[model samples]
Target: MRKVIGIGETVLDIIFKDNQPVGAVPGGSVFNAMISLGRCGVASTMLTDTGRDRIGDQVVSFLSDNGVCADYVQRFAHGQSPVSLAFLDEANNAQYMFYRDCKVDRQDINIPDLHADDIVLIGSYYALDPAVRQQVVALLDQARAAGAIIYYDINFRPSHRTDVMKVTPNLLDNLDYADIVRGSVDDFEVLYRKQDPETIYKAEISFYCKRFICTRGAQPAVVLADGGVVGEYPVDTTDTVSTIGAGDNFNAGFIYGLLRQGITRDHLDRGLTQQQWDGLIADALAFAAESCKSIYNYISVDFGNNKQLPNHI
Candidate 1:
C-alpha cells in the first residue's frame, strides 16, 4: 500500500463556550485529517514540530495510538507546545484565539520514500510560512517527480485575510503544485474577494489544477474536474456541537475515496471519471456531516463504522 505523508503544525485546542473552557483536543488542519485517515486503517505519517513539553508528549502519544507514525515529528526544547482557544457560538461555529511560543527551526527529519501510488496531502499556513515553505515545496516537488498526487487545501482564515498581497504568491505557487485543490467559500472571498465558489474554481483555481472542490457550508459543494462539472452531495444542516475539524475530515474522506478506488499518483489529474468524482465527493460530504453532529473534531464511531456512508452521503 502507498503511504500518505502530511507535514503541518500540531497544536492543542482548548474549546470554550460562554467564556468557559469546555474541552481540549490536540488538532491542526492536516493533523486532524491524518488522524482520521489513520483511524480508518490508512497507512499515514505526519511531519511536524512541537515543543518538548507535556502537551507535546500527549500529541505524540495521540498520533501513535491512532496508527499515525510520529517518527518524523520534531521536538524543540526551548518552547512550550502551541495551543488555541476555540469559542463556539450558538450555531456551533468556532472563533479561535491562538498562542504559540515560536522556536528556532531544526532540520526536518527525512521524509518517507514515495511510490507512484502514494499521495501527499498538505495545506494551511504551515505550507505557506516563509521559514517552512522551502522544505514543504521541496517535498511536494519530490512527490510530484515521483508521480505521487499532491493535494492542497486552502483553509485560510480571517486573520490572514489582510495579508492577501503578501501570501498570494505562495498560495498560487502551492496551487500550481497540487493535482487537486479544495477550499471553502470564505477562503476564496478573503483571498480572491470572490464569494461565488464556482467562479473561484473556474476563474482562479482551475487554471492551476484541473480538479477543484469548492465547499459552501450547508449548500452543495461544487466539483470541477477534467471530465465535466458535477455538483456535490447536499448535506442536511443539523445541530452542531462544534465545527472545528469538519473540513479536515472532509478532506480525509475524499482521500479515502481515492485510496479505495486504487488511484495512483500518475493518474491523479486525469484518472477519475464523472461517476468516480461523484462517489468521492459524496463520501466527503458524509464525513463532513458526521463531524458537524459532534463536539469531537472528526467523525463519530457510529458514522465511521457504518457501511452506509455512500447511501447516506
Candidate 2:
C-alpha cells in the first residue's frame, strides 16, 4: 500500500474567538494533514518531536486515535511541548502567537523506511530550521533516491520575514527536492513580495520545481506545471468556522487523490493529463471546504470516515 510520510513540528493550538477561548486541539503543519489522511484510512506516519510532558502525551494519543502511526515521534526529557494561541478574526482567519520550549537537540527521530510511490510531505520553518535542516535534507535525499514523490509546502508566515534572506538557500534547496510545491498566495507574498501566481511561478519557482499549486483563500486555486498555468479550479465557499487547518486538509485531500488515481513516482515525472489534474484539484477543494465548517484543527473524524473519493479518479 502507498503511504504518506510527513516530517514537521507538533503543537497544541488553543483557539480564541471574540477574545474568549473556544477550543483546544493538537495541531502542526504536517501533523494536521497526517491526522486527516489517517482518518481517511490512508497509511500515514509522522516524523516529529515533542516534550515528555502531558501535552506530548495528548498529542501522541491524538495521533493514535486518528490512526496515524506514532512510532517515529521523538519524546525528549528536556524542553516543553509547544503551544500556540490562535485568535480568530471576524473573517475567521487565524492570527497566531506561539510559545515554544525548544532544545538544541531538535527533530530527534528516526527516518522510517520509505518505498517507491510513497508520498513524502514536508515544509514550514521546521524544514528550514538550521538545527534540523541537515537531517531534513538527508531524509529528503534518501526519499528521492528511494523513488518517493516529495511534496513541499512553503507554509511561510509573516513572522519569518526577517529570516527570509537567511533561509533563501534552504528554501531553494527544498524546491529543488520537490516533485510538487503547494503554497497559499499569502505565503508567496511573504516569501517573494509577489502575490501573482504566474510571476512567482516563472521567476521564483519554475527554475526549481515544475509543478506549483497556488491557493487563494475562498477563491479559485491556480495550478502551474511544466512552465505555465494548467488551469484554475473553483473553491467551495462554505461558512467558515475557522480557517486554521483548511490548507493542511487540502494537502491531505490532494495526496488522497493521487493514491486514488494510482499516481506514483513514475506518474509524477511524466506529469498528469488535464483531466487528471482537474479531478485531483476538485478533490482537494472539497476537503478544504469541509474543514472550514468546523473549528477543529483537522477534518472531523466523521467526515473522513464517510468521505468518498472523487469518482473521475
Candidate 3:
C-alpha cells in the first residue's frame, strides 16, 4: 500500500470553555490528519519535532496509539514541548494562545525513501517558515521526482500577517510544489487581504496549482480544477463542541477518497467528473463535520462508521 508522509508541528492543546477546562489532545495541522488517516488503516508517518519533556512523550505515545509511525519525530533536549491554550467562544470556535521554546531545525528530519504513488501532506507555518523552507522544497522535489502526489494545505493563521510579504516567495514556492492545494477563506484574506475565493483563485493561486480547494466556514467549499471553471460542496452543519482541526481532517478525507479510488500521480490531475468530485468531497465534509462535533483534534467514531459513498464515479 502507498503511504502518507506528513511534515508539520506537533503540540498539545489544552482547551477551556466557560471558565472551565474541557479537554486536552495532541494536535497539529498535518499531525491531526495523519492520525485520522492512520486510524483508517492508512500507512502514515509524521516528520516533526517535540521536546524530551512529558508533553513530548505524550505526543509520541499518542501518535503510536493512533497507529501513526513516529520514527521521524525528533526529540530535543533543551526546551519544553509547545502547547496551545484554546478558549472556546459562544459559537464553540476556538481562539488560541500558543507557547513555544525550541524552534526545531529541519536538518534533523529523516526523509524516508518514497514510492511513486505515495502521498505527501504538508502545510501551515511548518511549510513556510524561512528556516525550513529550503528543506521542505527539497523534500517536495524528491517526492515529485519519485512520482508521489503532493498535497499542500495553506492553513495560514492571522497572527502571521505581519510577515506575509517576507514569506510570500516561500509560500508561493510551496504552492508550486503541490499537486493539490487546499486553503480557507481566512487563509487567503490573511495572505492576500482577499476574502473572495474565486478572486484569489483567478488572480493569484490557480496558475500555481491546478487543483484548488477553498473552504469557507458554514458555507460551500469551492474547487477549481482543470479548465478553471468553479465547483462547490456545501457543508453539513450540526451542533458543535469546537472547530479545532476541522480542515486538517478534511484533508484526511479528501486524500482518503483519492487513495480509495486508486488515484496516483499519473492520474491525479485527470479531472474527475462532477459525481466523482462530489463523492470525494462528501467524505471530506463528513470528516470535517465529525471533527467539529468534539473537543478532540481528530475524527470521531461516528464519522469513521459511515465511510462509504454509493454514488461516486
Best by lDDT: 2
TM per prediction:
0.93, 0.96, 0.94
Residue 74 of model 3 has an lDDT of 90
Rank list by lDDT: 2, 3, 1
Clash pairs for candidate 3: none
Residue pairs with clashing backbones, model 2:
none
**Predicted candidate 2 versus true structure: per-residue lDDT over 3-119, tens digit per residue:** 889999899999999999999999998999999889888888998888899999999999999899999899988889999999999999999999987553675468888889899
Compose the digit string of candidate 3's lDDT tens values, residues 50-79.
889899999999899887899988988777
In order, candidate lDDTs are: 0.82, 0.89, 0.85
Cα-lDDT of candidate 3: 0.85
> Residue 281 in model 1: shift from native, Å?
0.9
TM-score of 2: 0.96
Clashing pairs in 1: none
Residue 226's lDDT within candidate 3 is 72
The predicted structure with the larger lDDT, 1 or 3, is: 3
Whose TM-score is higher: candidate 1's or candidate 3's? 3
